[model samples]
Target chain A: MELTLGPLAYHWPADIRRDFYARIADEAPVGTVYLGEVICSKRAPFHEPDLPATIERLERGGKRVVLSSLAEVMLKREREATAGLMAAEDHEVEVNNAAGLMDRGRRPHRIGPFLNAYNEATIAWMAGQGATHVCLPAELPGHSAAVAARAARALGVGVEVQVFGRAPLAVSARCYHARAHGRHKDNCQFVCEDDPDGMPLLTLDGKPLLRVNGIQTQSESYVELVEALPELAAAGVSHARLLPQAVDMVAVARVFADHLGGMCDATEARARLAGICAGVSFSNGFFHGVAGYRHIARLGTAH
Target chain B: MTGAEDFSAAGELVCPAGTPAALRTAVEAGADTVYCGLRNATNARNFPGLNFTPEELQASVAFAHARGAKVLLAVNTYPPAGQLALWHEAAAIGMRAGVDAFIVADMGVARHIAETWPRARLHLSVQAAASSPEAIRYYCTHFGVRRVVLPRILTIPEIRAIRREIPCEIETFVFGNHGLMVEGRCSLTNWLTGQSTNLDGVCSPAAEVTFERADDGTMRSCLSGFTIDRFAAGETAGYPTICKGRYAAPHRPEGYYAFEEPVSLNLGRLLPELMAAGVHAFKIEGRQRSKSYVRQVVGAFRRAVDSIRSGHDPDLADLVALTEGQKETQGAFQTKKWR
Candidate 1:
């Protein structure tokens, strides 16, 4: 099993963003890399100029680079931007929502986690559409991913899993943050940047429920599949995607890579991960049909 | 010499059938069309204890057609990646069972229908989020789209503008639960877990939802194991969906409707105005409702539309108890009070 560093979903500046990828390029131990702006279309221009150097550095470090696309697809401007990204003759592209690519007739691309790939037909269809690797949606339970992995193997498409970071749950045209602040989407003036990770929303009783980005809302807890490494490998998951977070990403990558290589067990990895993470919690509920938040192991709850 | 069959409008009273009995009730209540789906992602209303199987759908179609009603099978959810076959087979089966139309979303699924049934009368599902006339017109121009159920985000005037632009007929939601979703794409359900109302055609799967008693004498309704809101005794609590419930946001410290309240949309009073705006059909919004709800909502809407056509005022107060939140709004039709 190998580790794949997925695209950063937040709106970090050019210096920080460049320096972050620079660290991954020089020192971080990961096999595959997905580099591009996967968030707002406006944010792409800031990172596009520096992408070539980042790609060159990562490629020199023996990593395969895949270009990422937007998550929420609607505006024609966003569509045109994605079209240009997909039309890049340089690197393989990962289709996020499968919007324009649906009728592109014949095009080679990687299907990202946001794209819906649930069963054999979708798997076969993606392979037929030229998907070399398909990252299953983060919401897909572990078993579903396993089943889809088997199907991918038959279709000659590889499967990837999201092992770390806050999983992006949904994207919308309406910016909840802007709407909350009584500002229109066009002139909202970069409010989402306050929470580099995302703004956590609590319930009426003060329990953390969800995190709100620009137009995206995610689980307040970062979903850590550190314990599911053996299970994921057994499920035929070849690549583990480590989503970027505002933490010790290098250390996080080291832990995930070590776990994937079978150097450490699930118990050791969980204990190490606990020390590095911030105030937020972690969950793996999508795997079971139980609550999205129900932890397999809790500190206070007696077994 | 004008007859009902020869009416230029051919205005169909599209109704919802949550149960097998409601299927019969809708047909008997002069509903021209009845729409439903299986209890899975095959339909948007993936509520528990509702929907039908292949045999049930076939039987429902026969029952409707035998009584001069048409069955429009709704296979509307965006088929999750690699799961297009479930939706594809649903379309094939709907056609084989003599369904009048196939309501659909997901460009991939739409492409499948276009390739398979070149002549099938396809109706774009509101879940497709085809809010603009240009978007609707694109579907009509590309696929063999015949009609579209406009999302609840548009005003009546906007609907009128869209009706003028698109070549296909337009269906507007008249009554029942109003989904505040931004149409074809909503991932709030999946954010909590991987299961969603969009992919597998469920919103908050019944199995994931649990009502718990809080220590402060309140009840919490959770979807995918997250608490959205809690209510005191006698305070009505609706089914929990992440996007809908009360929550504390960054700016708003006092907990309130973070996204939208689970209010039902009742547009019965605006039937005359909408028909005048060139809408061809009025859709009732409850497929998970009971047979009695089907009878009550469809019957009241039927009376209201007929009353408008006869140049008389229609009384829709009888539909108060059937709405999801026990309250109703005009949605985005009358004003900017939309979710």
Candidate 2:
């Protein structure tokens, strides 16, 4: 399966974003890189000035780039931004919102995970809408993902699954990142950038349960599917997505690529990944059809 | 103002009904339209003891039609892969029941209804989360959607701008739970529990809810073995929905409502503003509520809509007793500052 990098869901400094993409372009093993602001429109302009150069650099490095739309499109400017992204003729667009789907019309596009293509019939219908690829929601279980992937493959449309990084759980109209700092969404000055990986949200008992990134809520544990890669490939999944987190992504990419390329076993790859993202919890329970926060050990594997 | 033309210019008052009895109550209480779902995972409110059977739906439709009220079937949940049969069966039953419209979320279900019954009126369910005019127009142009129940994230001005761009009717929520998260996109409950509002058609299912009293005399609301919130003794505790529960962070160790407070949304004061914004229908959410709750809320809105149409300010009913946490806010309807 080909490795793909999902759009960054957090806000970072313009130079930081540029440097991050440059490394991914030159060193990371990901085949397709999704670039754009998928979380907040306010963060779009900060990185948009570097987009053309970044895309050019990535393409020059033999990486295919796809532009992604915002997950929430409520404001007029957000609508216009989505329309602008849909109008791009240089690269394939991955639509995360319905507005992008409408603006893209019958043009071939990718369905981002934010869009609810949960079932086979939904995949079939999206394929009818000229969708060339689809990334299933992170909450979907393995069996259901297999069904959706097979269905999309039958229609000659590629299917993608998130195999790494935090799972995006929800998006709210209110910005919790701002609200947490005692500010309104409109007046709050880019406070989400304080937490490059997202601010941790704990339960009343002080257990880290979720993370807040602007208006989006994400899983506290990174979703690690190193053990499920074979299952995904057997299920006809075309791409394995690795969400960009604040970590050594190039090394993270190498770990997955080595495993997929028969250079290492799942056990070795997982151990190396553990060293790469030390002190961070990893979860595959959502793929196991259980609570997303739980890290269910595979049968016969030592914990 | 004459009889039929009195509230003709005003938007349709759509009310919710969880049972056949509630359906009758909403219709008699002055609802122009009543929406309900079947007792299955096909609908978002797939709660036990709520929703209708095929027989109940047919009888309810007849009762509502006799009272000059329309009946709508909400098959709003996304059908899971290999489980499309249940949703399709529900849609077929809804059509057989002679409901006026089908409120749908998934594109596959919309395509099914449009293909099976070419003339069936389709209203885009809020579960679709189609907030932009382009999204609404896509549904209208593709599946002949007559109306779109917009997501609650849009402000009044945004709605007005959207109405000018879309070629369909608009529906906005006027009362009930404060759904701060975007519908169909939230998986907090699904992450905590196994069921979800999008696929399983349930959020924080009642079976998984538990209330325990700590030795310190705190009332703790738990869902799926996780403590969602803790309330002091004598304090009112809301349902253990993940979003409404309080949480802690390093910056605020005292705990805060990270997503939203336990307050409910009451747009009773914004009737005139919504009408001016070109909203064609006002929807009252709460299919899991009791018949009495349905009656009181629907009746209040009914009178309020009529009062506005007659060039008089609405003497809005005191619905504090029916609201969650006994508090209400205009939410995103009044201003963007609510964000």
How does model 2 score by TM-score? Answer: 0.97
True contacts kept of each: 0.34, 0.76
Can you write out model 1's per-residue Cα lDDT over A1-303, one digit (the tens) per residue? 889899888877788988888888877788888988776776677778998998998898888899888875545567677668777877888877545454333577888876666555557766876788888877676766787788888777888988888867666555666667766466667676677888778887687777777777777888888767777788788888898888878888888877777788778887778778857578776654334555565332411
List DockQ for all candidates: 0.24, 0.80
Off by over 4 Å in 1: A42-62, A297-303, B1-13, B28-30, B39-41, B53-56, B76-96, B104-175, B182-200, B205-226, B232-234, B266-282, B299-339
What lDDT does candidate 2 reach at residue B45?
93
lDDT string, candidate 2, A13-52, tens digits: 9989999999999999999999999999888888888999
Q: Model 1, range B20-90, lDDT digits (tens) per residue?
A: 77889998887878988876678888777888888888888889878878788888886644456678788
Q: Candidate 2, clashing residue pairs?
A: none
Q: What is the TM-score of chain B alone in each candidate?
A: 0.92, 0.95
Against the hidden true structure, what lDDT does model 2 obtain? 0.90
